[model samples]
Target: MKTNVATTLAELKKNEKDDFYSSISFANEEIPLEQESVKRKLDKYLRKFSYLERSSHQIHRKADQLLPRIAKILKSYGIPDDFKYIAVVESSLNPGTTSHKGAGGYWQFMPATARLYGLRVNGKVDDRLDLTKSTHAAARYLKSLYSEFGDWTLVAAAYNVGGGSLRGSLKRQRKDNYYDLKLNAETAAYVYKIISMKTVLEKG
Candidate 1:
């Protein structure tokens, strides 16, 4: 099984490299492969010397295992198919993932946010660890965020930071565009990371 997994990953890496120069469409936007930002992210994922390259490899391997079921759930919730990569960015498709800040699960929902989205978070059962349930909760949360922001990129950013924080940023900065607003490092990189993951997975 380990050998098979290795062989599969090797093939996936080869395919990913072959398509590294191709553009990908997400949220009705075309991300040009030749763009410096895109190229940088691709390098970060594929380069042997980059620190994040190993993590990127693990993410793609996990994504290959998780995305089919996730895509089905996203479709059922009327969420954009590309939004599946949020799980890749959040928890790398690890259903049991927990963050230092107390977020948990494949979608990295905090306890309160999980409950707010109708996910159970009691001691007996943490629904956040249940991929299907957490995905539904994430879809609902994302739908609400999109309703508030009207931009998928902003929605992705807001998912990392709270919607209130994003709204406050918009108000203070007087700019509604996600790329235009100066944000904390993590929030700023959130959408771009998702896009990068999407590109790698789609190409692989």
Candidate 2:
């Protein structure tokens, strides 16, 4: 009887191990996981997910709420639909959000950068908090960055770290590609964050 009980316990353990491995394989299969770069980005996404998950849901809700207006504006400006996800990663679609660095509004534009992008950022009326105006300003700034870098990923990185800084990094690193250039942690993760948000929003 003891021998039979031991054999049964061994079978149960083997079955449990097989089940766990199968679950992991199923999850990876569902997500179609591939590429080292994507895996790295997904890892970063998971680290930030605890803090950003609720905000991500809020962003999706806000996207649905404002879709018509935002879509019309984006269409008028000739910006791609996917660019809306940038705003999600920037401010979670909350117009009143202000970063520690003084970037404010749905697109999280710093005062100086906002002013340069044709946004009025005075004491009384900060246009950065105005969703319509801020989206337009963001579109214009993104268009200019796209013009300079000619690559959306590089443009997104430059948007986070500024065009001059990105240019300097490219020159110093002797690498024109954004992925090849080493950058500060925030700037390096910026594009990946945007990509992750885009993926989530699309899947939703």
> In candidate 1, what are the lDDT values of residues 1-204, reduced to their tens digit?
999999999999978865755544567754445567656754664443234544557766677788988889888877889899888778878878888889999999999999999999998999999888989899899899989888887888898999999999999999967766788988876777777667656655
Query: For model 1, how many clashes?
Result: 0
**Candidate that scores best on TM-score:** 1
Question: Which tens-of-lDDT digit does each residue in 7-31 have in candidate 2?
Answer: 9999999798556333322101132
Clashes of each: 0, 0
CA-lDDT, candidates in order: 0.79, 0.74
Models 1 onward score TM values of: 0.78, 0.75
Scored by Cα lDDT, where does model 2 land?
0.74
Best by lDDT: 1
- Runs of candidate 1 exceeding 4 Å displacement: 1-22, 30-58
Enumerate residue pairs that collide in model 2: none
| Alpha-carbon deviation at 128 in model 1, angstroms | 0.5
